[model samples]
Target: MVSYYHFQRMNKALPDPGSWDEYFETFLAGNVVWGSWFDHVKGWWKKKDSHPILYLFYEDMRKDPKREIRKIMEFLGKNLKEEILDKIVYNTSFDVMKRNPMTNYINEIKMNHNLSPFLRKGVVGDWKNQFTEAQNKQFNEYHEKNMADTSLDTHFRGLS
Candidate 1:
């Protein structure tokens, strides 16, 4: 869901189209987003037991940073101190990451900060505000049809 919103936002500055509907149609028609991601994640998920693949959901991590970080550390076989974990949580928090010029990619591409700040609102459900009714309908239809067989948990079911 957030990925959809990210794409929609990216479409705003891209040379794809003027309107959201047209932009979405063009982007989806290109088949870059879903095709690449599905193939990559599906491959990783397929060899989960054989390889060290821990499926991490963004929503789950956002909801519980400490728990998620601990899970990640465990996956990597790293048992850091509690204070260090707390420090990691504070340093990697959305606000800190967004504020840190080193972490944010605003300077890497020489993007004008006045026109676009690298990191926008780091929150879930922002897609509901951006996606229009017709856009949602189209996206839902396309997603339902294409992702019916995959195990990718998109969590995208229209707006509400």
Candidate 2:
């Protein structure tokens, strides 16, 4: 069965009109969200023994970009000048990426009805503005019930 995500993707990417057109896709998250962090982490974890994969958390990256940079350097077995490492970390921050059209891809997605701003307030607690208490409870329940088998965790981590 095609996933709602994939279906949405296919519908948008197809150039021609509807009425059963053969084509590719475009996708969006229902709540302007990204793919579930826990599921992705767990999926990569499950494949770790048999395949090569690297899992990263945006929160972790935000908290300590230099450390994340070092990890990437070590993973790729590359050494770089200290200044370059600092530059890379600084350049990759939410603030930097949001301003750089190349990184954010805001213009292209802006024309998309389903897609909103590629980068919102990079600050963490933005969801609080949009979700009510009841919605949050449902959000937690959804994760707790469906993501039960996954070991990953999520914090409503936002921009500081």
Instruction: Please name the candidate that would achieve the greatest lDDT relative to the true structure.
Output: 1
Error of 1 at 81 (Å): 1.1
lDDT digits (tens) for residues 1-160 of candidate 1: 3444344344444332345555566555655444444455556767876987878776777788999999999999999999999999999888999989788766524444554456777786677777788778877887777567677786565665
Deviation (Å) of 143 in candidate 1: 1.2
Root-mean-square deviation (CA) per prediction: 3.5, 8.0
TM-score versus the correct structure, for each prediction: 0.77, 0.65
lDDT for each residue of candidate 2 in 1-160, tens digit (9 for 90 to 100):
0122223443444342222112111111122123554455567777967986666766678788898889888888899999999899989998999889888664343234343344555655556565456555655665577668866565643222
> What Cα-based lDDT does every candidate model obtain?
0.68, 0.56
Error of 1 at 136 (Å): 1.3
